[model samples]
Target chain A: MNTYIEGILILAGINLMAVLGLSLLTGFTGLFSFGHAGFMAIGGYTSAMLTVKFHWPFIPALLVGGLVAALFSAIIGKVTLNLKGDYFCIATLGFGEAIRLILDNVQYFGGARGWPGIPNYTNLWNVLGINLVAVLVLANLIRSRHGRNMIAIREEELASQIVGINVFKHKITSLMISASYAGIAGGLMAHYMTFLQPKMFSLVKSTELTIIVIFGGLGSISGSVLGALVLTALPEVLRSFSQWRLVCYGLAVIIIMISRPEGLLGGYELTPSSMKKLYNRLRLKKQAGKQGLEGGDIQ
Target chain B: MNILELSGLTKKFGGLTAVGNVDFKVKKDSITGLIGPNGAGKTTIFNLITGVYKVSEGKVIFCNKNITNKEPYQIAEIGITRTFQNIRLFKRLSVYENVLIACHKNASYSILDSILMMPKYKREEKQLKLQANELLEIMGLSDRRELIANNLPYGLQRRLEIARALALKPQLLLLDEPAAGMNPDETEQLMLLIDDVRKKFQLTVLIIEHHMDLVMGICEEIMVLNFGCKLAEGTPYDIQNNPKVIEAYLGVEG
Candidate 1:
C-alpha cells in the first residue's frame, strides 16, 4: 500500500475511534460537548509522558491515557452536566480552552513549544485493531438495557425520570466513555506523529469531531465510521482546488445538511437486516395500494 | 391501609399556588380519582405526589415512608410511576422499545455486564423482552409492537403510555388525564381497563380526569379540587349530591 494512503487510513481510523465515542454522547445520549479535544490532549500528553519519561509499553500507556481522560471527564461532568442546553455547551468549550492553556504553561511537558521523542507505536494495523474493539463494544452497549435508558433520556428527560432512569448518572457514564475514546485516539495520534503539541488538540479539533458525528447520522455506529472516513479524506481529495478547498468543503457540508438534515443515515443502521426491513416495508405499502385499487374496481 | 398519604400538600409556583394545603389518602388496591375544572391544579397535585414539584408545605408519605423532597427518579424507584397528561412516549422508537426502556427499572445487570454481553446481561435482557411483550399484550398493543410510537393513533398512544408506566411495576400508579381526547366509547373502555388493571396488577391507582362518567363509574373514592383547594371528598354518589361539589361545577346563581 502507498505510504500516503496508509497515513490517511490511519488518520481516518483515529478519527473514527473518537467519532464512535462522540456518537454515544451526542447521538444516542443527546448530550453535546465541545471539550472532547481537551480529553484527547490529556490522553496524548499523559501517554506520551509515560512512553518518553517512564518508558512504558505502548498499549499500557494508551490504556493509562484513556483512564486519565475518563477520570477527568467524570469530574467535569459532575460540575457541568447539571447545566442544561447551551450553557452546558459553553462550559465544555471553556473546558477545552482551559486544558490547552494549562498545558501551555506546564514546562515539564515542553509547554507551548510542543513535546517530541514519542514512540511511533500507532501503525495502521493497531489503529484498525483498536477501532474494531471500539465499534464492537459500542454496538453491544447499544443493544443492552443501560443503552436504552440513555436513549430514553435523549428522547424525553422528564418521561425518562418518570420511568425510573437516573438521567444524571447516565449522562456522566456517556461523558466518561466518550472522553476515554477521545483519549485513546489522542494517544494514537501522538504515537503516529512522534510528537505532541497542545495546539494540535484545539477547539477546532473538537468541533471537527462533532461535525463528523452529526454528518454521519447521530444514532448509528456505521454512520460514524462512514462519516469519519469520508470527512477525514475529503480535504485531501479536494486538494486539487488548492485555496478553494476549504470553501468547497464548507459548501458540501451545508448542502448535505440542507438536503438530508438527519445526516447520511438519519438514525438508521446500515445492516443487512435493516435493508431487508426497508424493502419489505416498501413492498407491503405497494401491495396495500394495489389492494385498494382492486377493491375500487369491484365497487 | 392507605398506600399513599398526603398531609397539607402544597405547591406554589412563585406567586400562584398550584396546590394549596390539602390532605388525601389512597387505600391499597383501590382506584381513586382526582377531578377538577381546568386550572383547578389536579395535575399539580399529581406532580407533587410524583416529585415533579417541590412541596411548599406539608409532607408526602408513601407506604409509611416519608418521601418528601425525593428526586423524581428516586421516587419512581421507590415504587411510584406516572404517565404524563400529554402522552410522553418515546416517539422515535417502536412501541416495544418504549416499553423496554421502561423495563430498565427491573433490569439487574451492571453496566459492565451490558458492555461485555455477559451471561447475566443476556438473561436479564431476555427477561426484559418477555416482560415488555407481556405488558404490550396486556395493553392490547402486541400487534403494533413494531410500529413507531409517534405513528400510533391517539387512544393507543395513551394506552402505550399507561403500559410503559406499568412496566415500572409500581406499587402506586398515577395517571394524568388518561381519558383526555378520547371518544365516549374509548372513555368507557378506559374505565373498564383501569378497573381491570387495578385488579390484575394489584395496583393502587390515582387518576386525574375530566371524564366524569369514567371517574364516577370506576373510582372507589373521589376528590374534587377548586382553585387549588380540595372542595369535596366522598364516594361517587355522595360527591354527586354534595352542594359544594355542585357549586364548584356550576357557578353559584347570580
Candidate 2:
C-alpha cells in the first residue's frame, strides 16, 4: 500500500477504537460525553512516558496508558454520572478541558510547547490486528447478560432498577471500559506520530470523536466502522476544495442528521439474518406478482 | 407468615403528605388488594415498599429483614419486584429479548466469562433462553416473541410487564394498576392469570386496582385508603359491607 494510504488507514483504525468505546457508552448505555479526548490525552501521555522514560515494550505501555485513563474516568464518573442528561454532558466537557489546561501547566511532560522524541511503533499490521481483537471483545460483551443489563438501563432506568440491575455501577463500568479504549487509541496515535501535545486532545477532538459515533449510527458497531472509514477520509478526499472543505463537511453532516437522524445504520445491525430477511421479503413480493399475473387481475 | 409489613409508613412530597402513618401486612401465599380513589396514595405505598421512594417515617420489614432506606435494585435482589402504573418495557427490544434482559438476574456467568464466551457463559445463556421462552409461552406471548415491545397492543404490554416482573423470582410481586388499560374481558383474563401465576410460582401478590370486580373476586383480603389514611382493612366480604367504605365512595348527605 502507498504510504499515504497506509497512514490514513492507521488513523482510521485508531479512531475506530475510540469510537467503539464511545458507542458502547453513548449508543448502548444512552449517555453522552464530551470529555473522551481527555482520556485519550491521559492514555497517550502515560504510554509515551512509559516507552520513553522507562523503556517499556509497546504492548505493556499501551495497557498502562489505558489503565490510567480508566482510573481517571472512574473518579470522574463517581462524581458526575449521577447528573441527568445534558448536565452530565457539561460535566464531562469541563473534565476534558480541565485535563488539557493542567497538562499545559505541567513542565515534566514538556508543558505547553509539547513533548517530542516518542517512538513510532504503530504500523498497518498491528493496527488492523488490534482493531480485530477490540471488535471481537466488544461483540461478545454486547451479546452477554451484562451487556443486556446496560441496554436495559439505557432503555428504562427505573424499570431496570426494579428488575434488580445496579444502574450506577453499570454506568461506571461502561465509562471505565470506554475510557480505556480511548486511552489505547491515544497510545497508538502517540507512537504512530512519535510526538505528544495536549492540543491534539482538545474539546474539538472530543467533539469529533462523538460526531463520528453519531454519524456512524448509534447502537450499531458496523455503522461505527463504516463511519470511521468514511469520515476520516472525507477531508483528505476534499483536499482540492481547501477552504470550502470544512463548510462542505458541515453542510453534509447537517443534511445527514436531518435526512437520517438514526444515522447510516440506524441501530439495525449488518448481520446474515437481517440480510436474509430482506432477501425473503423481495422474494415474497416477486411471488405475489407472479400470482397476480396467473390470476389475470381478478376483479 | 407475613411476607411484608409496614409500620408508621409515611411519604411527604414537600408540604403534601401522600401517605401518612399507615400500617399494613401481606401474608405469604396470598393475593392481597389495595384499592382507593385516585390520588389516595395506593401507588405511593407500592413505591415506598419497593424502595422507589424513601420513607418519610416508617419501617419496611420483609421476611424479617429491615428493608427501610434500601436502594430499588437492592430491594429487588432481596426478592421484591414491581410493575409501574405505566407500561415501561424496553421499547426497542423484542419481547423475547425483553424477558431475557430481566432473566439476566438468574445468569451465573461473570463479566469476563461473558466477554470471553467461556463454557459457563454459553451453558448459562442457553438455559436462560429456554427459561425465557417458557415464560413467554406461559404468558401466551409465544407468537409475538419477535415483535418489538412498544409495538405490542396495550393489553399485551401489561402482560409483558408482569412477565418481566416475575422473571425476578420475587417472593413479593407488587402490581400497580395491572388492570388499568384492560377491557372487561381482558381484566377477567388477567385475574385468572394472576391467580394461576401466584399458585405456580408460590408468590405473594399485592395489587392496586380500580377494577372492583377483579379485586373483590380474587383478593383473600382487602385494604382501602383515603387521604393517605387507612379507611378500612378486612376480608373481601367485610370490606364490601363496611359503611365507611360505602360513605368514602359516596359522600354522606351534607
Ten-residue segment with the worst summed lDDT in candidate 1 chain A?
Answer: A290-299
lDDT of 2 by residue, B1-254 (tens): 99899999999999999999999999998999999888999999989988889999989999998999899999999999999998899999999999998888888798899888899999999999998999999889999999999999999999999999888889999999999978899999999999999998889999999999999999998999999999999999999999999888888868
Per residue, candidate 1 scores C-alpha lDDT tens digits across B1-117 of 999999998898999988889899999988899998999998888888888888899999999999998889999899999998999999999999999999887888988898888
* Every candidate's lDDT: 0.92, 0.92
Error of 2 at A267 (Å): 1.5
Identify the candidate with maximal TM-score.
2
TM value for model 1 = 0.96
Off by over 4 Å in 2: A293-299
Candidate 1 residue runs with Cα over 4 Å from true position: A278-299
Error of 1 at A61 (Å): 0.8
Model 1 global lDDT (CA atoms, 0 to 1): 0.92
